[model samples]
Target: MNHASAFDMDAFRPHDHGRCRRAARAAAERECQARGLRLTPARAFVLDALLESHRAMTAYELLDRLREAGLGKQPPIVYRALDFLVANGFAHRVERLGAFVGCVHGADDHRAAFLVCRSCRQVAEAVLEAPPAALTAQAEATGFAVERVTVEAEGLCERCRADA
Candidate 1:
């Protein structure tokens, strides 16, 4: 499911986040139902936390939230939920930051590119229609099949630039 090829810059600007969060939640519910996956309370809570902001959150931060919400105090609790969310494509792990964020575009397994704000740590997701030609060629030369690709570009966002 290819969406608009344009880069998604919603995280850098102010918008109706309530609508975004609601839509993402609804999408997750529908996906889970279709896939026969159980969206347990703890998993739902973790998804909600990740969707609360575009900022990536570390597992420890999520664990803190879970503990405060009286969900579970153990590290494994959060890890398990994260594993489910990621495996089901409802969330993504930002490897550069060692954190997680909700799938703003829903769960289509689309190739993803991220624009990360170095100052505020906000991340904007974009759809990468295809891998770079050079990379593909290089991989072909080496007889390596490309399975997945995630691009992360770091820079200051509009607000951060203005402040600077």
Candidate 2:
């Protein structure tokens, strides 16, 4: 997976998950409205499914859900929706797993860092105020223009650790 290190397991800690999902959905809706973006059926459904859990979900997994829901069986439908969501900051890709997660923080300025659960594969996003120092220095030294960056950490979550 694309990762720099491991992290604390605060994401797997208990809270009102249903409430969190609702809040996330509401935020997405608000952001879409503000930006004049379309929260299309396919895109909204995909976001809802991802937000149902903190886990990163593969395209195949999500495609199955879409098929069962009769949204669309074609891969392009989901792929296109994913493209829009990721481009608009409504969703993010967890490159390590080649999966996607709904962005709960709405469209914000912070860069996303993640604590990834290796067992369950649930990801909790952390906002970084700036790029990591090493990457910044490297880019500057090379005169390379950095457009985007994703920082991820992998390890077990509390539940997985307990299970072990």
lDDT of 2 by residue, 95-144 (tens): 88899987777554346788888899988886666778788779989999
Residue-level lDDT for 75 in candidate 1: 100
TM-score of each: 0.93, 0.88
The global Cα lDDT (0 to 1) of model 1 is: 0.88
lDDT of all predictions: 0.88, 0.82
Show where candidate 2 strays beyond 4 Å.
1-10
Which 10-residue span in candidate 2 carries the lowest summed lDDT? 1-10
